[model samples]
Target: MGLNGSIPPDIGNLSFLVSLDLSWNRLHGGLPKDICIHNKLPRVKELQLSFNDLEGEIPLGLGECQQLEILDLLYNNFGGHVPREIGNITRLTKLDLHWNNLSGTIPKEIGHLSNLEFMDLGSNKLRIHPKRSREQSYTKTQGNLIQSQRENCVLFVFTF
Candidate 1:
């Protein structure tokens, strides 16, 4: 179905929604402030809203989606910095916010997402501060090793 204008605030009513794909549409206006109100979509795993005409800041309440695993909002007209509360979603594994007009420092809280494996923050005007000199160097060397091992394990599982 073709959805134009603003996304309805009642969208959160889809309690059983596992994935919501509204990409490449003409949907305009700001996202509802309480898009994820009532803790709806407790089982939602993926939400794709890329390449739309939507504007304004991303709803911070999205952090309440505990079961959210993938959130793609690329190529939109979204502005403002990404909400730091996004780190509260511990189950997030993949987050893509590339090619948008978003600006400002990427929240340090993002580092707390231990389960985040695929993060594409490219092409945005976000400033990412490196960890302290010593910590940065240590994580670079040690973290790379750990990340490589994890990637290998993921690849192995996928291949099998």
Candidate 2:
């Protein structure tokens, strides 16, 4: 089907949805604001929406998917800040947001994702300009934490 305009508000109704494949469509506009309201995909393992016309900031509610392991939003028109809440998904292993129009700093909270194995935040306008020395220190600390986490893992692929 040729899904156009904004993503359907009722998409959250698929509570049992384990994997959602909405890639390569003409979907546009910001992701539904209520995309995760009253809906929780606890068993969802993968969410692929790559190569689409999707635009706007990723919904913060996506962080609610506690079981999400793979999140692919590559090759889209999405822009705006990458939500700090994404760091809440501790189970995330593969997160691909590359090839988008997203901007703003990568969230420091991302360091909290202890289980992230493969991350691709490249090809986006992610500017990390720490205004203060303390901020820079904190960001560096987070970077070290990520490095430590990767060191402990046998396999990890990260691209910024």
Candidate 3:
């Protein structure tokens, strides 16, 4: 489908919808601010909007999608710090935000996601917080580490 224009805010009205994949499309625009608010999409487990032109900071309300397991927004134009609220999605297993314009310290809260099994946050301006560097480090058994060229910035992929 040759989708063009923004995602309809009314999509949140689908109370029983589970997953939504509008990836690989021309959808260009930030996600509706309230679309992911608690109970708006109580059952959504996957939300893939990759390969689009969507821009802006990742919604702070996205954490309300408590049931989300896979959130893929790779290859977009999204910028700003990766929201700390994302760590609230305890059920999330795969989060691919690769190749975006995101910058600032990678939230330390991310280390608390015990259920995260795969995450690719590379190719962005993100850096590990100096004080949290030790706290963010995982053993070899937890995941494979990929050191970035940026000094003091280490990005890893937790794949099991």
Best by TM-score: 3
Query: For model 2, what is the C-alpha lDDT against the true structure?
Result: 0.72
State the lDDT of candidate 2 residue by residue for 39-148, as single tens digits: 56657788889888888889899888888888999999889988998888889877889889888877777667777676777678775545423321123334322222
Stretches of candidate 1 off by over 4 Å are 130-160
* Candidate 1 lDDT, 1-160, residue by residue in tens: 5767778888888888999899888888877878675687778889898888888999898888889988888888889998988888888887888787788866766656667777766676766445533321112233222121234112000100
lDDT of each: 0.71, 0.72, 0.79
Residue 5's lDDT within candidate 1 is 74
When 2 and 3 are scored with lDDT, the better candidate is: 3
Of 1 and 3, the candidate ahead on lDDT is 3
Clash pairs, candidate 1, are none
Candidate 3 C-alpha lDDT tens digits along 1-160:
6789998889888889899999888988898888788689889999999999999889988888999999999999999989999989999888889888999877778776667777788778876565645445343323334433333434463322
Return the TM-score for each candidate structure. 0.79, 0.78, 0.84
Clashing pairs in 3: none
Q: Which one wins on lDDT? A: 3
lDDT of 3 at 96: 89
- The clash number for model 2 is 0
